[model samples]
Target: MKLQVVLVLCAAFALSLQAPSSQECWCELQSEEKAFPHAKLSMVERNVSDCNRNVTPKKTLELESLVLGLDRRIALLHRDISVLEKEDDGELYGVLSLYVVENEMVEIQQMMDKLNRTMKGDQHLTADVTQQLTELQAEMGEMETFDTMELVKGRLATQLLKKDLDNCRKSLNATVPPTQPPQGTCPHGQLVNVTGPQVFTGGEYPGSYLYGAWGRDPEPEPGKENWYWLVMMTVSNRYSNYVRLYSSLSALIVGKSVPGNIIIHSSNPTTNTIQGPNNVLYRGALYYNCYNQLDVCRFNLTTNTVSSFELPKGTRYNSKGNFCNLDECYPYTDLDLATDESGVWVTYTTNQDFGNLVLSKVEEGEPPRLGQTWHTAVYKQALTNTFMACGVLYGTRFVSKDVEEIFYALDTVTGKERFNVGIFMNKMAPNIQALNYSPVDRMLHAYSNSNMVSYKVWFE
Candidate 1:
């Protein structure tokens, strides 16, 4: 019995000895187990220690970089905001400003990504790092709110600026110079300025001159007030069909006359002719259309050289399917040319049963090209019409058509017709042969067989 009890005691002692110390057993169990039961606690302890040892320095460096990046972004945002504030409504500045906010969002997301990667590496750091990340997310959300507010503010400000600009334009347009009586004392029988005959003189009419026409001078020369230059188209009236060019100061005609300077002459007589001289000054160059050959030419007064370009061969000049010809049977006459800050535009008529309006753009670059060609719907009611005018290009609401004897404020770019002034129909009796705009006076001048009249135009 004594031996058995001793044996049992010894066995108990041996079993106890075989077992590890508490800390040792804990470590051993961790090694033996498929998964450590105290894995989270172990990670927590190690992370705590590492945090104490390295987090301060690492966080300091990270914050420095983050702050630097944020400062740069903030500065950029401020600059963009300033720009947005100054631009008109619908200006791309606002969109560009929004890009700054987007960049910030991207940066924040990248920071979050980095934070997430850091958290993944250390399980114990997850909660604390997640909390910090959440705080950053909240800050980002606040930034988003700020961004949205700024965008709204910028949009509102831009709208207001545009409105102000428009109002100023209208006010300026509505302003007119005080009216004055007709110049020069009148004799009894006929109106003093009414009975002048068409005159032509020397070194003037080149033999090549075919069709010569002129527009009313809106703002006349200072001393020779009521004077405007006439744009003359002269083709080799005899043979070769080669065309030449001329212009005349309306007040200075001596005989059946023409102007000097071969502004544009045809090189390939078989293929081209100076079609129509719709004289226009654009970007410091004089541009006109050559009707017969479907070409446009630019004469640089400064350079004393002419550069020519052609339109798409298939462009519909007038609705009548009259592509390019000078004969009356063709149903269209290429008449008017105008330009704005953006580019040059030309207007021509189609000889179809119903008169059609054709508008085209001149392209840019080393050598210019013809761009989009568009045509207006048939104006069957306005038949026998021979004149049209583009008074303003941008921020303006007016175009002049002679048939209705009205000034229509139409969106020439978009072809949206606006208000029309119907007061001038009675004045249309004699027919307005030429229409022109004077930038100096901001007026539309109409030339009839007998007289030249001016109308004030307003724009916004």
Candidate 2:
């Protein structure tokens, strides 16, 4: 009905453009420069009684039906794109992206064929219908090229990631033990459960810097055991070149008395600088994803030195695979750096794993390197956030605006997983952007929205 109305208006406007009957007098309204396919407007003539009539041209009604068919096809095409957009398993225009696009193209061709058949031998086709058909043919010509280039790139990424997956499997001749630390290193018993936010602090920059990570170092390098570190994305909420060090929890909350500041030289993304919000301060060094690359960079605050090692090939980075719930995704969170009672670890996903979180130990060495890597069945983007506790990789998803639940866990020792862990985490803010646990305080620190929240963990 709406389409018919639109067609009526256009037909009336077009008809009124004809030369006025010299004998007729018609009312006039505002004129000149109307919208769409028309450069100017003029007074249109219509019988005063035509406004009250319910009559419409048969040709306009026919055009309405044809346009309505096109509308339905356009709607279906939009829904197909939405399905490709909303998946957390991986990125759009990835593995299945090209296939979906190609299928739509085929459907479009079928629509064109049917339209051509219907118009055959109909020499009196309206100009509007002819215009729409010409546009469709032009668009189809452009789409044929899209089907080839993107598919080639997608296949290349898959092949590279497959090689990396094979390398990861070969490196793990033995299981990566649950405990990477030495005997009695973690006096805290196994992390059995986590409680709600015990303390919520909105530092000076509350709500100003949305994407960031803050927590205590489970193991300190020397005299910085009591210090708290914060690293927030400064450039586009995706890149940072410095970290703010607070002496105590109170100092962090106050946002003042911050004398400790470690700056990573060369903020340029192509250099050795911070890239994502998934960074953690561990043993006087900050571990984070390096800028514009697939490498984990370790910046030692005490020594003021930087070391980095490349991540597995085809590992998603640069906002490709991020921490996301159904509603939204935290940008540049492709590589998550975390610390547990056992040791520091990094979690990410690749094409090979189909977006499942992959855990690799960030071993402390002269030139920091990746140690044993373990794979989990939990999809990386499916969950809101993840953390390592006592060699167990735990993932959380949104239960509510103020609540997040740890529903997935993978034990590195036995290579076993549990998907039914019912521990729930309540927060002061709506989203948990970054989460890490500190063995020293036995508290889970989270960067929520623009606030810092801590939760107490209970061990069985």
Candidate 3:
């Protein structure tokens, strides 16, 4: 019988060494690092890139719905906690209820943290969505529940999320996506605005009137004074069809459409003019406004070929009338591209962003893309023109012709705005539309009425 029992025990041990006969297994309960199927992490990363580039209304609505639900739930929980604390009667049951409240608060905080992470850096938020986020942040700030909240002082997570949301929305809304705006032709007639003042060629200003200039100040040279100028002649009451180019020292046209000639025939051909008169000459190409959109026409000096790069959407570019802020309304010269020590930068406003200025570093290619961006508190409509000098963005407002001033300057390094530049403009041309600064000589160039003038800027 003992021998039989030993044999039975050996048989059972042999069975255990083999695969389990029962369906239930301990291996199934073990955790897996990658629980998701079909390369979910990679797919999520791609989706984030796509969302940044362009946002669909459906996706926007879905996110908004989620945020709204979380907001409502948080509010309700906060109210319940407030009531529980108020009705406390110092009993054991009351203390136990408080413990339960604390547990609920912890759970709610976790959900909030997850929701905030999802929505914070998303670029799909619209003006309405932004308003909702602001309200949610305010509510979170008012609630005091966890020790971490007090240790950090206020709702730090909410504040960071607010900032991320604001920047993402601003940068995303700043441009018409590469896929959206029409190609081959401009959608909004002319690209530039002509309401400021008509450029006069012969009436009071008699010489070859300079509308724009780019490059260094003219120095005494034998034959190679390479500075360029855009000379204009007023043709009719509402339009000018001919624009000339000349070397500042040689007075020879540098732009040629014909094989041997020095002029390129260009016309607005529509009621809308260039978005902003401010233009930049980098390397050997000239970058200027193409249409009401943020698209910039690049005119090559060597090949005389004109190609366009679509820029980010601008504020009030499609507005039927003017943009009105808290102060006064002004015509939208909605997009401005300038050059400084670092490289090129574009400044514009978006209607959905409450007319705030969005500044971005311009990366060049077949189609341009915006790089690091800084959103400013100053309204684009408030400034007549903006330019970058020595890696700083300076905005000018035309109080009057004689009262043009550097109202605001943004430091790109620190992303801070300063109002105390103290440099003032005296006797500025009437209705000046563009202002650009040259780092070569530290002179500010002004384009007004079809006349270009340079001013000496002294830094004390």
- Per-residue lDDT for 103-172 in model 3, tens only? 8778777777767766764644555456655654554454423243265655687799999999999998
Worst 10 residues of 3 by lDDT: 190-199
Candidates in order have lDDT scores of 0.44, 0.77, 0.54
In lDDT terms, which candidate is top?
2
* Best by the TM-score measure: 2
- In candidate 2, the residue pairs with backbone N, CA or C atoms under 3 Å apart (3 or more residues apart, or in different chains) clash, namely none
TM-score of every prediction relative to native: 0.37, 0.59, 0.46
Candidates 1 and 2, the one with greater lDDT:
2
| Candidate number with the higher lDDT (1 or 3) | 3
**lDDT computed for candidate 1:** 0.44
Give one digit per residue, the lDDT tens place, for model 2 in 1-460.
9999999999988887885656877787874533332111111112223322422343333443454455556666787777777767655455587587678878777776666665652443345445645755565554445444477668889999999999888788756756446522335665566754667888868788888889898877676778889988778787888889888888888887466667897554558889988889877789999888899988888788889899989999989999898888989899989888777889999989998889898878878889998887888888898888777788999988856889998878778898999887766678888998887888999998878889877765
